[model samples]
Target: MSTPTASRQDPSPATDAWLVIPLYNEAQVIGSVIGAARGTFPHIVAVDDGSRDDSARQAERAGAIVVRHPVNRGQGAALQTGIDYVLDRTNADYIVTFDADGQHSPDDARAMVSAAREEGLGFVLGSRFLEGPSPVGPAKRFILGLAAKVSSRSSGMRMTDAHNGLRVLRRDAAERINLQQDRMAHASEIIRQLAATGLPWREHPVTITYTDYSRAKGQSLWNSINILVDLLFS
Candidate 1:
């Protein structure tokens, strides 16, 4: 499987994409993730969504501009915050929404950003299922695949994955998107909105390393239930 770590020879992403990471209580792995990402993408914004741990400090120390949410707003909210910050603060052409956990790879991020820039796509979504089987359990994969189907049906865009956290968006597309669902359901909401607005989009094959820490930190079964309920009713 292709690893997601960026190579030194690859064109730097700092000039192309503004990285945004939204995490809550990711103290253990966020530091290293930010440090590694900073090597390729220097302009990074990490949103600490009311984390009680040292997540903000670690990201700050790793050279990320930290944005703090006094209350734990969901990942969607944090991402929007980071995006808004970058749009208002910098003249960035592209915005990359990256997972705060160590699951996402910087190499894949760079490729997606490069793809968006070269192809002139308004949105680039990373898909783990495009190449081969994901590095996760069968049950988890099934659930995620079901969620992808749900998103596809709602959005009218047929794709292999929808809940993937890695994405690159053009400035105009990023500015137009509004994430109403603040929690897990926000993933599907994003797809639905993008499709609704008719953005030029593409999905790129990417890697997701599902470690024990990431697995533990992921949404629980009940959270999944809540997400489905929210998607269905709200």
Candidate 2:
């Protein structure tokens, strides 16, 4: 990984939380996403996973700390690098894993962090299926539901949505995470590792807005199957 580059604006002192975004080639919308998220949570670190486009520059211009990987590492490696950077460099008390795509709501992220702080919880995972039916299509919903059940059974933690990217981890809980799965399978690996930490955790109801852009860039059905396979084997 290259040395992290920061924008001119400093992190706001309004909140003690930092959002860790795994960035790929979302140059078209990354600036807007970062701008919107910074309104609520000022500190953001966008780990650029070797994007060929101008994503890193856009994020940096939008007031995010840009940490570029020399090559195309997967999302898991990007996330781990962002987490490690936050732990090693910042005094942030909470770390939030947010997607570079615009599917996740900044409001939901704020709520999760609030819930974690209010309840003295170390981990708060976003669950699309928590309050009611998720907005996902039927086939995708079914697959994700099945994946959640399998993850819950294997990890010994009942989760409604195991693959949601939005999550809040207190410093103590973040310290316990060491992701070896440097790919999409890290979603399940995260649950297993967090459960092993035995930290108090809960699922927060969250809304995932599946925009046309996000749908186009979202994980494919084949990739979902690969995640299941990885969960079972890894």
Candidate 3:
């Protein structure tokens, strides 16, 4: 993967594809993620979801347009905030969602946007299973990948990574995907909305990091069963 930039000048994103990062207590890696994104895109918004740490301040220091939540909303809510901010404040043609724990690659962001534009795909999901050399453990690789396949089949999408945060959405599609779930279940909700809308969707390969920080903060394998149960029951 290409090295992320520590700081960079402003550069326009492809067709105004704004990058939106939803963060919790990710002060440790938020600055690096923003800096790595650099001038690669013009609008990079970081939504701090009521983190106990100084995540919002660090994101602002890294030159990102930061938004804050008064209370601890979940990741889905934070992402929704960023999406709404870009749609309301910026003339963005596309919106890309990314993780703030340095798990996602900034360079792959452009590729996802390009693919969305070229294929008229309303949503471009970043698929780890479609790519090579993932940092995910074997157990997670089996459970999540299997769940994704099942969900894709149910939703009529041929996706391989439904849980990955690295996704590019067309403006209309982004606006349409109103997340109802505030927690981990939001991932399934988003995909369900996409399937319900019957919007053109595609998946692109992306690299994700599995550092100790990410693994610690990430959802556990046990939670995977809960997510599926939520999807089934709701």
Candidate 4:
């Protein structure tokens, strides 16, 4: 088995890399996740996409810069809002879009930022497929792996984890991402956009913990089929 990469500190200083977390109805996990991320990244921005629960308050209490939307928007929309906040509020050199759940690790967060800084890549994706401790079940893994392959073929990027949300993007590449779909398909669309724009991108393996809570919040098997159907039909 391949060993985990050594954790390297971000050489670009603390204020350059901003962690952007978009959440909806993740009150149960938001606080803990924010606290965990805060251990590594100082600038953590959490966008509450009109969650019905008290996710915003939890994030704020956990030391995240909370930005609340008035109505429930999709994950893609929430991500866009967070990106906008990063562009407007801070002079961030790199922006990392992290999940609100505990699937992503703080070690991987720092590594991703460091990779982006050192490698001069426009974006770096935390690929669960390449990374160890991938928590997805066999069936879901097969489906997602196949989808990622298809996305790679379509985008000509040879990406390992096209749909993983834990990713870091340079300021220019991130600002160029315009999410057209408000739903889960935005994951695939992002690859397409990056490919079309010829952005320098790389994928690094990271651990994914598929707890019962995260599984419940994740895209359903039915939703996967719906995403493809929407992409094909639209």
Candidate 5:
């Protein structure tokens, strides 16, 4: 993947962590998401994945540093671009992988970063099922649960949610991550690579707000099944 140049600079003070958001065609909610997150996390990098909407402009207006991909890339590629941007351009100690949609919570992200710092953990994965049942539909819940079990067996790292878009990785663990699966399969690929790092990691309970818009944009059952197959064969 080519390095994307930042569209603008973030005026916030240098912090210990940076939120890396993989932005696509989420112009409707990306601005508010970044605005709310900026209250807790000042340093945010939104990698725009060739969005045809106004996502890049909205993110820039919300005070986030925007990195634009010249063409449409998969989420994994967008995430890797954001990660590389943080590592190469900033001095942050932690990198948080946050969703561009308004599903993930800024509070959860802040808490995960706090846990990583307080517990000396290198990786913190967000799990929607850790604390209790999530608001997802029954079919989606079953699919995700099965995927998590399969991922645990294959990667040797037990996880309650395999494809959750919220995660915190310290600089060292972030450096070890090289996502080759440039699509939905990268969710499981991330677990496999992170497990190989032998870093201290744990799952954190996170709330996923499935609003009407996010629900409409959620992955389909067929795609979920494909991710399972990827986990099994990759």
Candidate 6:
């Protein structure tokens, strides 16, 4: 539970904002990914969810405060760990959940933070299905569109993109959330939790770049079904 380390990247004047990157077995590109994130954020907490590779080492080398899990946990657990680290160890006014897989962009994160401050929103969700056509292919577009509809129907909110990983939570909202689901299903669980906790939320448009690596690591339709099952059982 040491204080999260600072990187050589230019620190934002608002020291209370912390970016938490939850990843497992992403060593191949975690360094470069963290380096890119450093361009916008200074304080970073990279949670290594028991990756067998050198993810923690590379994250450290790239100047991220590394938190290691003794065993592999789901993304939900990793995010909860990072958020807990921020809550317990730092006076983090804001916490942004950014992916280590390079699918997410730092610019969108900066915009979310700005929106949180200017609009005084407790939660800011990044939506890919907002204005224009998505950059993704037809299959992905259909799946994501369905996911958004399912999430909106389940949570009773006008959700544009349901399972998007990029999100910003104000400190109070961050503390109130309790993520019990440890896998990809946690995405839906998040929306449910927000609804239950009565946290004020807003959404901003964002893009999910489909790189070769991200494409390879993308979830299948079966995975989506499993997420639905988890949400139903919970």
Query: In terms of TM-score, how similar is model 4 to the real structure?
Result: 0.90
Candidate 5: tens digits of C-alpha lDDT, residues 96-147: 9999888898878887787787678888998899777688778878888999
Every candidate's lDDT: 0.82, 0.87, 0.80, 0.80, 0.86, 0.81
Can you list the residue pairs that collide in candidate 5? none
Single out the weakest 10-residue window by summed lDDT for candidate 6.
1-10
Better of 1 and 6 by TM-score: 1
- Summarize candidate 1's per-residue lDDT along 43-111 as a digit string, tens digits: 999999999999999999889999999999999899889989999999999999999888888888888
Report the C-alpha lDDT of model 6 over 1-234, residue by residue, as the tens digit: 011122232236446588999979999999998998887887899999999999999999998999999999889999999999999999879999999999888877887787777667788888887757677666666776777777788887777787888999999889887888888878888887776667666778787786778766655555555665665566
| Pairs clashing within candidate 1 | none
lDDT of 4 by residue, 32-73 (tens): 998877767889999899899999999999999998889987
Residue 63 displacement (Å), model 1: 0.2
Error of 6 at 190 (Å): 1.2
lDDT of 6: 0.81
RMSD of candidate 6 to the truth, in angstroms, is 6.2
Which lDDT tens digits does candidate 3 get at residues 1-234? 111122222235564788899988999989988998865765798988989998999999998998999999898898889999998998888999988988888778888787776666787888887756886768877878777877787787777787888988899888888998888878888888878876777777788877778778865677767666766665
The better candidate by lDDT, 4 or 6, is 6
What is the lDDT, from 0 to 100, of the residue 186 in candidate 4?
81
Q: TM-scores across all candidates? A: 0.91, 0.92, 0.89, 0.90, 0.91, 0.89
Misplaced by over 4 Å in model 2 are 1-14
Tell me the lDDT of model 4 at 63. Answer: 92
Question: Model 1 segments beyond 4 Å from truth?
Answer: 1-9, 219-227
By TM-score rank, best first, the candidates go 2, 5, 1, 4, 3, 6
Which pairs of residues collide in candidate 2?
none
